[model samples]
Target: MDIDDFGPKEPTCRMLEANDKRAYFIVRDWNLETANSLRRVMLAEVPTLAIDTVEVIDNTSVLADEFIAHRLGLTPLIAEDVDKLVDFRDCDCEDSRCDNCSVTLRLKAKCTGNDVMKVYARDLVIESMPPSDKLGQPVITDADGLGSCIVKLRKGQAIDMRCIAKKGIAKEHAKWAPSAAIGFEYDPANKLHHLDLWYEGDDPKKEWPADEVRIDLDGGPEKTDEPFNYDAVPERFFFDVETVGGLSPDAIVNNGIKVLQQKLASVIKELTGVDEANAGLDGAQSPAMDGGFGNDGYGNDGGYTTPGYGGGNAYAGGTTPYGATPYGGAPGW
Candidate 1:
């Protein structure tokens, strides 16, 4: 809620409505950049537990190992303490698998009766899963527990497998995604002209109808309307987020904000390092980083142009100077 920490403008987001699967909110006093950043981060940055690797000990089912594995990967998992788990690649343990970074799921099903049996997501039993009774399983929509039919088995068909779940983000693989869908919109009325309606006639109202939500919220267009303001900007953003499972809509938004904060903090840290390094070199000047343009850059008072691409920056010589980053240290840039 203390959005001042995220930006200089001190924007705030208010939840308009929310439920188990979906949430609606509005962010005020912010620009398009910040609003879009939240949307993208929510889509691809939020972490979740997914079946990354599968071990098939025995399989007599019709589906191939790869096919069954792919289905299991896309199944929505309930990861309550996903943050407590670490990425397998980042774990410090010597072993390839451990409790710190890996979860084991055991699934074994066989059809004994004459009737055909179906395998469901609920069939996958949680084993070696971290202890977290605080977060109970979601309400099962039906007897199958909202699990789609993975594979059907005849009288003797059977399957035995153990799946390995790991922590990951949607950017790497969509199986780790938490959000089902997210709707982001700003300036819904289009008063700012960010999107122009291309209609055949002069009055576009006949062909293009106004958004019902806008009409309802703003009352009749004739009852109350404000003239277009030249200084207008995207100061309010509306968001509606839906989650697949485990993570609530509020949690998804909060986690996305945390990821965005970390990214901004990283950039700030890198910039601070650059600023310090830029100040260390004595009388060193780089037109690129320091933004000095007066009498030093190409074809100045001497009427002589600098050679090579980028003209007078650190890349002019096609080599990095001082063994440092392009923005910090050295005099070429």
Candidate 2:
């Protein structure tokens, strides 16, 4: 099987602070199968002799860290461990918020006439409606629109807080065990990991149901015509590892290359017309022109003739008294 490394390439953390408080968060394992699958699709699309090797590592801990950073008014530290959290930073706090921990901006003005004010993730804009002091709100956005927060303002004041939404993947949010807390480690030297997938076989829980098994070895195995089939020996699927974390090794294995293969087949079929049938004519092959009365053309009287009612070159034009073109552009004119 080809290896895919779609996870974090560099392991480094960044300090995140909000409002004006300090807190702690930890890194947990991350789960990503869709990204892995998309990477495989890219490999299949490209022409290469060597198969793609992917190693995705998700520091699931980041999820909690993100939430914590957003909750407390403080900057988050970038580290694998909590000890990395520190008080020192480039900026310090002021007012109820902080320049280091929280961001604050203000606007002061009095409307002379009828006007309206609006604040969005982007620049403030006044619509057709007149400005209203009670409708102004705070707007925040990062360099990229990917990160942004918008709030309505009334009476010329607005305050807002941004945090990792509860909708995201996190223990406090949404965590799916046996599929959530999972990480992948690959040894390029050996090209193997602790986890593998099987499609047909017994699992560590004795729930063997794979149609195939894919063993991701840390090192290259000796060349052999035969591969280990989990279905044949249901006992082989039994790994001593606990399924307490993310997907059991068997679960990942069960999502074997076959599933990817089927997907690839479908993608290949779509990308390349290899499976499309070229049988018969793309357009129908009607009989040769027989200049019949049903032909469509100017009749003997120089009037546009309809099919089957034609007295023109119907026979030559494949329009006969009986072979008139249908209104829907059929055999008739």
Candidate 3:
């Protein structure tokens, strides 16, 4: 079947509300399955930089080293430069860490002389910064102007640790999720035009717009003749998304689309047995074919056949109840 028979090649999007942290939009001419796929990608596939490993150098505080590491991993880091960052597993470096694949963050806190102290995300020192203007400091701050508080310490207590941040998707962990919420729903306004408002309410005039109310109650419940048409449009969906300050709402959506495209490209390459690196080469041959019956290059035919039950049908002697024929065998063979 032709590919176009599946669905529209391109879907349309319309933005209704947009801001730094939140966005609401509409997608037209797309099925519910497509809309849901976009939402899933936004929530779980968009990549972001997050603290993945921690090395504790010293700790005499109330919190254990593992607890501290857990808190550090949850602290959202500045991930706007994720596109420029490489995954540690995919990097060429043979060691456990490298500049291109990971960034180091250090935190040190001490409390002394009868005073209680608090350690926050701002205290985590980023050893290096990416060469991008869009990214700021790595720590995330709350609306109260306080960074993500790691722990509290009593007098004479101290803590010191180093963390490694890496680029990853939310599917690995919640710390890497770029968006807080992503969802879509059918627009209800599309169904409003089909309702008969006249007979549904006490005072029909008060229940709907003047143009929608058609009964002339003052003239004895008679209906005024008017031409009208329902305005319901099919396959329209409204989407709402919220970002987690690691990236903008728009960036999360754009990245989700990019990730989806890459996944589709990979699937197509696998199914077509095409080596993308050599696809553009001069006179590069296609992969060896697996015939309809999946035969090896040798002459042995590989297809379903009834062994003792079939003959004279397509195979050579007597006819059988089951229709079993050799691969590519003629009827008289």
Candidate 4:
């Protein structure tokens, strides 16, 4: 029998709602540790492209050199296939700044009109990049073509610079963070009373406004009027993930899962002194662990296969059978 049948059932995600930059989903069968790990990975471990170095060629605008450089470093550059790019440290280059490791963008904006002109992120131009590198496109927040405002310039003022975007995670700097904010809450109704919430006014609900979990997911613990369950435990989780246009919300969740799997693989290797990836291939029996350690999360039920994962992807681009419910189990509760 397959080893996955012996361990924790894999956790599954049902996408509640999604847009270009945000997604609402619910995860089931995951313990507090696994759920919290995924949340932290999405916030920190998922790699994305961001501006790391800024070289100001010339600046006559009101903004100082340091200020302009700082603004340039914070611009959100979009590269949908960011996983194809290698991080600077992992590249084969002896020194940093190679076609494989870095992407260079140029910004040259001047105020030709008499009135003050606003220089936006769209003003930045993709100067040079790797052969397969499609990086450093400014994210458009609105239809006005004003992506993210860099700096304003008066008439006869101008700014010129070159920016370098590299692969990185949010742990290094906020510039590389793909998410704006991640809403992680299990019991929104306080029926669990996980925390002894303090309230000064008449009621606690009025003072501590419910988070987006209650407002969004119907599957979440939003039924405040229902009877408080004295015997309930925090089993389900409501995740409202808002990304910053760097990676898709689907990708963020998928990537987080992969990161956890990798960590588990390392632990397995250290404990058993055997490579888990090649465990059963040689007709040698290895230890059976949770379904989370399996390559494909499905319990091999009906020959069901996982989708939305190929290269360095965290999620399948399309819907999977795992959706519509928490589907399976994982290592712990």
Candidate 5:
């Protein structure tokens, strides 16, 4: 057996840790690989400081399709598909528990919500033991007013949630602070029902990979007196899932900014060994850690105070800017 398939790279490292946390994050071109990494980071009970939830809560409830497409990293072919919204009630499959109408996304963060309005998903990863739950069993992130609640549950649990709007990384990553947040207690005796958001789509790529077997040179179909027997066909065929666009152009642009910013922050950290807080991204100027503050407080003046909102007075007043007077007060005041 080749054990090298499971080694400690970024993905593997993420799968083994425990009790981690996050503040703010910005990543781009997020695909299943990154999403899988994130799943591990959440299950390992990692900590997150910012107000963002590990789960992407679908609040609009209208853009269920968009949220699923974002999580799956599926770029829609048609622009209108971006807004091809659907709700949980769109399904006519008798029971409302099937995927003919919904898609499920479950994530957990074992941390506190003390920071209310200051959470982000940057540099955050979670790990777990059995990975994800079988179909129909999903961790729902919806609970109370907790936009970023932390729950204690084993594998195969359900999570329902809603996340905050982020203006991307450029304007500072937004935290997942719901109108309210939840704090869960470990209820051992109580059995929780697994909740899943079902959707209508069948694609092999979305399904887990099947197990592979190698037949020996002389191997043939072994006759069995057993009640059941499995057959094998070495032929291969491929099928494509129906493609549809998701998210509006504005939303794509906005989300893209956040992703790029997160990517930039990660790269900068790798090259300079600097944390996001001190990297001059979140309002503060990057400092010249060489013992003295440089020209703009950063080495080679690399950091500059972000343009405006430093003192909560909006941009510096030169001439009446937009909806304000140059001096003080409201536009006309």
Candidate 6:
């Protein structure tokens, strides 16, 4: 069946607020499942570049190599055009390291004389450019210099390491998560009626942000004559997304929807068994061929074969397939 048969063909979305790192929107005509799927995908399924493995060539600092490597893996990298990047598992190269699947970041820092030095994310430089033009730099940076400070160094301390950044889902590790948080709530204004606001002071509106307080004064009843109504409109959800600076909040949301679409398409393909090359053939047929056998027309013994040949059946007299002794019966039982 076509996907449109499941629900509305096209859902409507209205942007309530948006910025570089955060966004708030309202989705209409979609079920709770759809909204929650988007939320989970944004938080855990959306792929982003992160330092997965760190190789410390030399470390003269007081910190252990394992600790330094752990810190490196937690640092988020800039990932703008995620589609252009290839996942490490999908890359053609057989080895664990490859240019197409990973980017190398090098860091070499040392403190001289009485000077105290600090290593930051910016200090670690991308060895090569990513494939996409949209991704100008692999390291996330701003006017404040680097995105975050990695470690501090004393006058005689030094650190040298190579970090490998690869595309990964947050399910494998949280460092790959694109969004910091994704959540949604039912908008009460869509159906709630007789909403009333009572606050002290001359101007009640001044107490809070204008966007925070919203009352539907004309939906069902008068506020002065009735208690507050708690009803909500169905199929309407207000969503909020916060990014971890790897990508813009809008990009995270869009990528989440795209990932969900791809997953659904894969499910549909598996269920329909529509092989593009072998169209019109029976798709329901099992791929495995049945070998001639004694019982079920296949080689499977159904656990009835003699011991030392195949394996004894579950009700066998000597020993069951799981090594348990059968109770009160011959091999047939």
Give the TM-score of each candidate.
Answer: 0.74, 0.19, 0.66, 0.73, 0.17, 0.68
Residues 191-225 of candidate 3 have per-residue lDDT tens digits of: 32434556565775566554221122112232246
The TM-score, computed over Cα atoms with residue i paired to residue i, of candidate 2 is 0.19
The C-alpha local distance difference test score for the whole of candidate 2 amounts to: 0.26
- Computed on alpha carbons, the lDDT of every model, listed in order, comes to 0.70, 0.26, 0.68, 0.72, 0.27, 0.68
- Largest TM-score belongs to which candidate? 1
Higher-lDDT candidate among 1 and 3?
1
Which window of 10 residues has the lowest lDDT sum in candidate 2? Answer: 46-55
Per-residue alpha-carbon lDDT of model 5 for 189-301, expressed as tens digits? 11121223244567532453322221111132233554432342212111111111122222232233333444555685554333532433442211223333322433333
Error of 4 at 139 (Å): 0.8
Worst 10-residue stretch by lDDT in candidate 1?
278-287
Q: State the lDDT of candidate 2 residue by residue for 252-275, as single tens digits.
A: 222323334445445634543333
Clash numbers, per candidate: 2, 64, 2, 6, 48, 1
Better of 1 and 4 by TM-score: 1
lDDT of 1 by residue, 1-333 (tens): 544355456677777788888998888787789789989999999888888888998789988999999998887777677777777899897753577887777779999999999988778776774646422222234554656677899999899988888888999998877898999887666666788778898787688777777434423243235666778667788899988885878888877876775676557436434222222221122222342322243214321233222334433333343234545354865
lDDT per residue as tens, model 6, 1-333: 654365534578888789987898887777678888888899999888888878888899878999888888888777886656678888898864577888788989988868667788878777756676545244554787666778888998899998888889999999888888886676454334223556688764566344333223113222466565554334677788988888899888877876775676566445433322121112112211232221243224553233333344323332223234333244767
Clashes of 2: 64
Q: TM-score order of candidates, best first? A: 1, 4, 6, 3, 2, 5
Top candidate on lDDT is: 4
Better of 4 and 5 by lDDT: 4
Off by over 4 Å in 4: 1-10, 131-134, 201-232, 270-273, 278-333
Please write out the lDDT profile of model 4 over residues 1-333, one tens digit for every residue: 573553766667777889887888878766677788889998998888888888888899987998888887788888567766778988998866677887888899889999989988988888876545446688877889789889999989988888888889889998888889999888666657787779999887778877664635435444668887787666678888998887778777766666666666667455434353343222211212344434544234332244322342222222332233232434565
